[model samples]
Structures are given as C-alpha cells and as structure tokens.
Target: MEEGKICRTNPESSDQVKAVHMLLVSYPLQGHITPFIKLAYLIAGRGIMATLVITEFAHARMIASEPDLGNERNKVRYITVPDGLSEDERNDDVKLSQSISEVMPGHLREVIEKVNMEGNQVTCVIADPMFGWAFEIAETMKLKLAIFWTSAPGVLALILSIPKLIEDGIIDTKGSSKLDGKIQLSPDLPPLTSADFLWNYSGNQTPAEIMFQYFFGIHQNLKRSGWLLCNWFHELNPLVGNLVPNMFPVGPLLASGKPAANLWPEDLTCLSWLNKQPAGSVIYVAFGSITVLSQHQMDELALGLELVGRPFLWVKRSDLIKGGSSKYPDGYEERVANRGKIVQWAPQEQVLAHPSIACFLTHCGWNSTMDGLSMGVPFLCWPYFADQFYNRSCICNGYKVGLALSPDEYGIVTRHEIRRKLDSLVADDGIKVNALKLKDMAHRSISEGGFSARYLDNFIQQMKE
Candidate 1:
C-alpha cells in the first residue's frame, strides 16, 4: 500500500495487489495516440495503474470530440502537457519536432516526480521512440525506460538498416536516396524502394536535413532503450525478430469496451447505414488522418466509386483535398446518393467489424491496416506516404490479402485503376480466404496464452520486478 512496493503472497494469505504504475508518452498525433491508449487499457486490465500523457493541443481536441474521455469508469488516467507550439504550427512536422524537443522534457520530468510524490511511484516510462528525449529524463529519474514502436515491424527493421543502407551506397548520410530501385532487407520480408524511406515523404514541406537528423536521432535512442515494444504480433513479420532481437511484439492493440480515443468526432450514423446493407457487399474507405489528396485524384476516386456501384461508406475529412475545398465531380453525389454514405469521420473499428463490409480502400496507415487485417477484410491499397508504401507491400505481396492500385505516369491513381483494383480484389476468392486466415491468426495472437499475450505478460512482469 506504499509507493514503490508490491504485495507478495505468503503462507498465511494470498491477495491480488497493484504491481506497477506506468506512464505512457506518445507523440501528439492520432496514429501514435491510438495505440498508446490501447496499450494503457491493456496494462490496466492486468491490474497495473496506467497514465497516458499527451500534448495540450491534442488533449483539447480529444476532450472536445469525446466529452466523456476522462470519466472515472476509464481505467487509465490522462494528463496533458504544453507542447510549446500554436495549433497551426503543430501541422508542420519539423516545427512540431523542434518544439517537442525544446519544451516537453521538463514538463515530462515534472509529471513523473509529481506522480511519485502522490503515492503512485512511477515505475517505468514507456514512450514512442520519436520522443527520444524521454530516455534521458527517465534515466535521470532512475526509472526503467521502454520504447514503443507504433508502426509495422518492417518499418523498424528499415530504420535499423539505415547504417547498412548508407554503407551500401543506397542512401546518403543525410537520408537522401541515391538509387531509385527495389531493395530487400530480408528474403522473408517484402521488397521496398527508395521512395519508402521514412524521412523522404515530406518532399520539400520540411527541410531534408532537419528531417534526416530527427529520424537519425530516433534511431540512436532506440538502440539505447532498455526494452523495445512494437504494436504488431510475431507472425506478421517474424523475420524482424531476427533483425532487431530486442523487439517485443504485443499488439494489434485495438480498443475495446470504451469509446475510442479519437481526435475527431465519429459519425455513428454510418453504423446504422452499414446494418442496412447486405453482408459482404459494401466498400469501407478511409485514408487515415493526414493524407491529403489532389483534386484530380479526388475526382477520379469519386467517379470510380460510382462506377463500382456498390454500397459504400467513405470518410471524407474536411481537409482531405489539398490546397482547396474537397470537391467531387459534377452531380456525382446525386448519382450515388441512394447507395453511398459520406461523413467527416466514422467509428472505423465498428465499421470494419460489420459483416456487411467487403473490402478496405485505404491509405495503408499502420493502424488502418491492422484494423482491416484483424477484421478479415481484403484491401485495395492506396498508400499516401511515409512507411505506407512499405505497409502496402506487406498487405499485397507478403500476405497476399490485398491488391495495389497502380498510378499513371503523371502520378495519379486513375479512376479506371480504382475500379479495376476493386473488381480484382472482390472477385479473387484466394485473397478473401487469406484475409480470413490472417484474421484468425491476429485474433489468436492476442487471446489468452497466445504469443502476444505471453509477451505482454512477460513485459508486465518485468515492470513489476
């Protein structure tokens, strides 16, 4: 019943006692926050007290979207720290990274010390490796520090291979790709190209040198982390274990029983619409939080969906189109009004789990990919940037449960291509079968006594010690 103490069973009595209290810190992005929240719930389910810390800007959006977020019924406690940036400035990756480095460390240290003084001794800090500074703070406090990889194991593997890639003359020290060909990190993994380099996606939006140093710093911190936790199961990328031996896979960390910790308000009306559709007869389309489409591409996609003539639910975020309003082809809405449903956002997990959902047309963000995969939905991949192209390779080539949409010389995925890919994805019985098999494996990995469950238990036990 005291700080830094756990109950032990004796000959006279046996009792369940709180073993540890963990503080989870994530980069204030939707993709990163989603998994950290899930992991918090997972830890609390094991009788450990969990606290999740986020930037004040993200916290405000979350509270506005989900007013009941911090209710007492929730097992995890939530905290917010000033990120030292305006809401608009946070949209730029380089500015966000700079502000976080300059501002968040002292605040995080205060949080840990305050929590310790309040009788819940902070046992460990599990953080997104992107926040490399947390490692130093945890070290100063003499607490165990672990890094959580929020993306695919393959992405981590690719980051781990940066030195080798530079040695092989595939990339420069500044993270620029010297060659534009395919590469295979391991025979067991999917092949990638220079375009998939994590830092190369911004394309002049952020200075190359700044982005390069940011990612390189993260890579260095990952090597120094006491433990590495990834949000994927072993079966998904078994070869990554051989590549990064310290990595622990304890996920597909999806939320259950509580409202999702989403930054945007979800349109629950879509669920009722999904119920009206026939089983396996609807397309579920969403491109995560950050993908911005070109007007040409948006027009083409709208027409393609009309061509498919299937009942579809699409998440058309207000910021979906770049540099302008999100506008579709003339009368496109009226033409498909009877069968199509469009909303600013939807409860993605519930929509995917619905029996009426057929396949996912996705930007291939890791969280969206896992959601679709775990639900047994086949995919029509339209990766936007960052490691998304690599995730697409895993979905299409490594797992054989998805099909990639081809882009033309002008760099647009044409309307015809979308229609064709969807047709192929739906007609292929093999892909459907593989998708269900993958779903079963995902479910089993997270179940009791399963691979991920055992790894999670080991992680919790280590924290307890």
Candidate 2:
C-alpha cells in the first residue's frame, strides 16, 4: 500500500485472469466523488484495476482531507484534470457546469490516450452522465461506455420522461412546466409539481434554460450508452426498474474499509461526542455540499435547533452561508453550547449510523437520502433544489420514513416550524419503524443473492466480455 504506486494483479497468478481495467470519471462534487470512490473500491475488490479521474481542485481537497488517499492497498489509482474554474467560481452551479462542458472533454481524452499507452489498457469508461462529452470521447476511441447515474433512479425516470411530457403538452421543448398543479407519474409513486422537475429554476429562467439544455444533451447521450448504472436498490424505488427498464441498480454505495472520500476533513470528534449522548436522542443536521442558506435563514435554523432543546450535531460547512459569514444570533451559541456540537464537516455515514441520532434534518440530496435511509434514520426534510425535491417526495410521501419542513409565507423554514418538525419526527414510532425497515432492506440489497449484488456481478461479467 505504498504511496504513488499503482496496485496491479499478481504476476504469479494465472494468465487466464483477464486484466479488466475501468476508468471512472466523476463530476467534481462531494456527493459524486464519494460514490465513485466507493465504486472504485468495489470494482478493485473484484480483481479489476479502477482508475478514478477527478478535477485537480477536488483532488487537492481530497488529498488534504486524506493525505494517502489512493495507496496501493486500495487498488485504485487516482488522476486529476483541470476543471477550468477558480476556487471561488466552483460555488456557482451555472458557471461550473459551463466550464466542465467546455474544458473537461479534451483533458479526459488525453487521460484516456495516456492510460492506453501505459499498457494498462482501459477496457471500459464509466462516467457521470452529467459529462455527456465523455460518451463522445469513448465512442471516438471505440471504448465501451457505462454511465453512472448518481441520483435516484426516479430522478432519472423523470428526466427521461421529458419528451413524453413535451408531447403531452405538459411541458415545452425548452423543459418548462406548463401545469399549475401536481402531476402523478404513477399511481404507486409520489406526485410531483412543476417545481419538482429536474430543470426547474424558481426565479431565474436563464439558469433553468442552461440546466435544461445540459440535461437534454445528457438525455440524448444516455440512449447510446452501453450500460446505465444507478446508485440505488430496487426495494427503495421498485417502480424505477419498470420505468427505466435498462438501468441496473447496484448501490447504497456506503463507505467500507477505506476512509470516506470527503472533500473536507471530517471532524472525528463528533463521534466521541455522540458516544456520550443517550441512544436516539440527538438530531443530525446537514445540508450537503452545495446548499447555501441565507444569513436570516441560518439564524432561524440556529434558533430552531435551540428551540428543539435536544442534543444536536450540525455540520456547518465553511461555505454554508450564501455571502460566506455564517454568523449566529446573539447568545445563540451560549444558550445551546451544552447540548450542541457544530463542525465544518462530519463523517456523515458514521453519524447517521450512530445510535444517538434520533432523526436527520437534511437537504434531502440523493446521496444524503441514501445514507439516511440505509442507516435507518428518520428524516426532517428541508430540500433545496432540483432532484432534492424529488428525493424529499420519496422520503415524505412514497417511503413514509420522513416528514417535510413546511416553510412559512416568506419562503423560510422558521425556527418554530423546525422545532415542531423535530418534535413530531422523534415522537412518531411509525416513522422509526419504517426507517429501520428501509435500513434492513438497504443492507439486504448489498448482501449475497440480493438484487444489487446480482446486478453488480452481472455488470462485472459484462466488463469481461
């Protein structure tokens, strides 16, 4: 497990062992990076060489968090490419997406060519579908391409149904929703409104237009992709399999023997703090990586946590507040200092898995949703945007394992509402029962003879062919 060494198969092994090498390209974001890394470890465990490619900025953060990230023992090699954005610009979704589309394709091409020249020929290219250009490169190089859909399969189904929506006059070619009421995709699934559309931007039409075009391009590319892999299980959303028949669900891709692929160094101190709290007594609050709360909203959240009067662990990222200053209300820290622990970032999976965690107050991002569900933690959902709304619907309505925090007239989830939600969430035994049920299902999905296990095996077998 030496540093700067690429772990390979043993030379003493039989030559019949096909050197199946996979190149995984992740969209440079925390949520995407974690599952992609887990996928790399999973593939490497199966006697395949997994080369994970990410942006240079993300790589630097990853290395900063874990100095020896891709050691030989992990059996995964790491590579970095320029994302063509400055550190500050990374926060802007539109700018970041534009840069990735414009700048990353050539760099990805160079990486592929260089890897093939090094004798460890990349037999397959597995990439996040956000980077549609990867498909073009793989096609040009005559390499097999498998797209990794990081979000919920339901989200994918929704995106893929865009054409139908347009044809039915529910939406336009530009991806805008024409309806004022909620639309039911199926009788069994939760209903969604126009706001729940993947490309829906509330106020800014420009960003919505940009995102629509971006996803539309990805949608077109998905048809030609050799394989479609999702980071979820059949039991979580069984209807997704019927909706997107070609997709293979092989996840809940949680961390295993290796450290979590975190962009920020996790404060392990929180684990020790959780150890002291009573079982199922603490609320875990985190809004994932990209959610930026307004200053007033941040203050309200702080007051809300205090009002809940429960032991709480909150992950307050450095860039959590919109304008950067995450200042709290007057004497807010002093009032809740004894019961609260705040960190820049936490080991989320471990936190969610902890016995002290009663419920989660989350942004309902797909990765966080999977983590919460797999850990069997009931949720107090506060979704931000895009697929998050859909994930919230799954949590609140479909699965019935969580409750959504309704915002006040001003579009802010006030302290009173937060307190009420937390109170209700912890009191509801039904929610807890459902959460545990999902947890068992999630674990079973990855175990032997499970749907995810069989699909993963099939995917690896396909790689050999």
| lDDT, candidates in the order shown | 0.84, 0.84
Worst 10 residues of 1 by lDDT: 5-14
Alpha-carbon runs more than 4 Å astray in model 2: 1-18, 203-207
lDDT by residue (tens digit), candidate 1, 1-465: 122121111111112323477889999989999889889888877777888888877877887887767766667777778888886998788789889889889888887877777667788899988877898898888889999999987788788888898899998999888876799887778887877777877644667666777778778988977689888887887777887766779987888656578899998899999999999999999999999988998999999999898999999999999987987788888999999999998888899999999999999999999888889999999988778888998999999999999999998898899898898889999999999998999989999988889889998888877
Off by over 4 Å in 1: 1-18, 178-181, 202-204, 207-209
What TM-score does candidate 2 get on C-alpha atoms?
0.94
Evaluated against the true structure, the overall lDDT of model 2 is: 0.84
lDDT of 1: 0.84
List, residue by residue over 1-465, the lDDT tens digit for candidate 2: 222223333232233233677899998888899999988887777777788888878887888897667566776778778778887899787789889889889888888777677677788999998777898898889888999999876678777887888999998988878988988775556887888887775744466777788778778877878688899998877776766656788888877648667899989999999999999999999998878899999999999999989999999999898776778898888889899999999989889989999999999999899999899999999988778888888899899999999989999999999999899999999999999999999999999999898898899898888
